[model samples]
Target: MSNIQKIGNPARQSNNLLFKRRSILKTLSLAALLPVGLGAYPSGIVIAADGVPLPENVMTPDAALKRLLDGNKRYVSGKISVRDFNVNRAILAKGQNPYACILSCADSRVAPELCFDESRGDLFVTRLAGNYASLDILASLEYGTAVLKAPLIMVLGHTDCGAIKAGMKADKENVDFPGHIQTITSELKSAVKEGVKLPGNATDNVAKENVRLNVAKLKESTPILRQLVADKKLMVVGGLYHLDTGKVELLT
Candidate 1:
């Protein structure tokens, strides 16, 4: 079986059980704690005493992805219900415990949340022009994995990435930048060089290579993440999202 299927299936089953149990317990707990006038009763419904709905807690990466895929299905099928902005906003105000951290491109078309069909606070995402790894990006990823305790770190790339295109065109004489943009292109130079020799379009080859390199970089650069991997506490994966088809394909 594929890694995505392995990670996704068990988590899906467990999350369903967890949600059912939590829902039942929450209803019972509220019913017992509230006054009779408040009308909080255990009828398998989630109505707060303050007349607000409780926020659904999605704590696991697998569950989060399932939710995203479900939302994507809804989006594709034209079945998206209007979001409960007030309820969602209120719940998120307390805090967030996102399940996964995504390192992806700054491409307008590659919004991780929208592509994954996740809501706000569902993912800890970091974007760079080429989804290149830098010290700051590594630190942020460490923060997400170590501090935030996110179970998964996804290195996401896409077809026809503009940054990769730019890297392909870069030469020693013309490699200039206003500020940090140069740094991004500089990092991507090697991937582009390596990609050009590979048998594919520069964009496609670079995109896949970038994901693989980033995943390897994360595993090697951060001791915290390395320990997590050693302990099986976390998973780092590379994926390619097909922009035209809106499909995500895991890279082994």
Candidate 2:
């Protein structure tokens, strides 16, 4: 099956119209069970596969995370999937239903798509200098989950991050970064404070701490995402992308 047709597509409803409505009504009768807590969706919910294009397995947070890690394994092995972009373009143009959402750094060295080995519509990505979840980034992530139904969110950091380094320097030396670059450092200061207490590689440690803070922020975000997480419909995770090795190490 084509990627578009892999799940029951809602856009194609025009063709069947009444028949699809009838099918939806029938499916609703079997979908009354509420989803359980954290990383699971109720089995009954999987029956109504209309607008959500993700497969039943991919709908769960754990499965979605596994898919990303598995893809990363392929990337680290230098055997990434050979994708046919031409075949997916028309389908993707209609709508997107990404399995995962990634908040990554806006560093040229760290490309989330390449690191995760995901194609065009597989991930909904938001990038910033420090990969921190600012209010704006939180809003975008909420939309990814509540509106787009992305099951998983990952805050990706990296080794030798300039932002973390700047934050560390600013905190230690009381130096100011120029322009709006200071905003990134300001956001990362708390991570620097926590990371420095932990012994080795203070800058790299700060980067990982930054990812952790953002991951916690997303999981605790009010209304939309917090409710989804409590009901087991969504998950938030953290990772550190290794630039030299092309590997993503999941941060605890």
Native-to-model Cα distance after best TM-score fit, residue 92 in candidate 2, in Å: 0.7
Off by over 4 Å in 2: 1-58
lDDT of 1 by residue, 183-239 (tens): 667778767767777886767888898888888877765555676777766778888
Q: Give candidate 1's whole-model lDDT.
A: 0.67
Query: What number of clashing residue pairs does each candidate have, in the order they appear?
Result: 0, 1
- Indicate the worst ten consecutive residues by lDDT in candidate 2: 10-19
lDDT by residue for model 2 (66-132), tens: 9999989999999998988886675555556788999999999998888889888789999999898
TM values, all candidates = 0.69, 0.78
For each candidate in the order shown, give its overall lDDT on alpha carbons: 0.67, 0.77
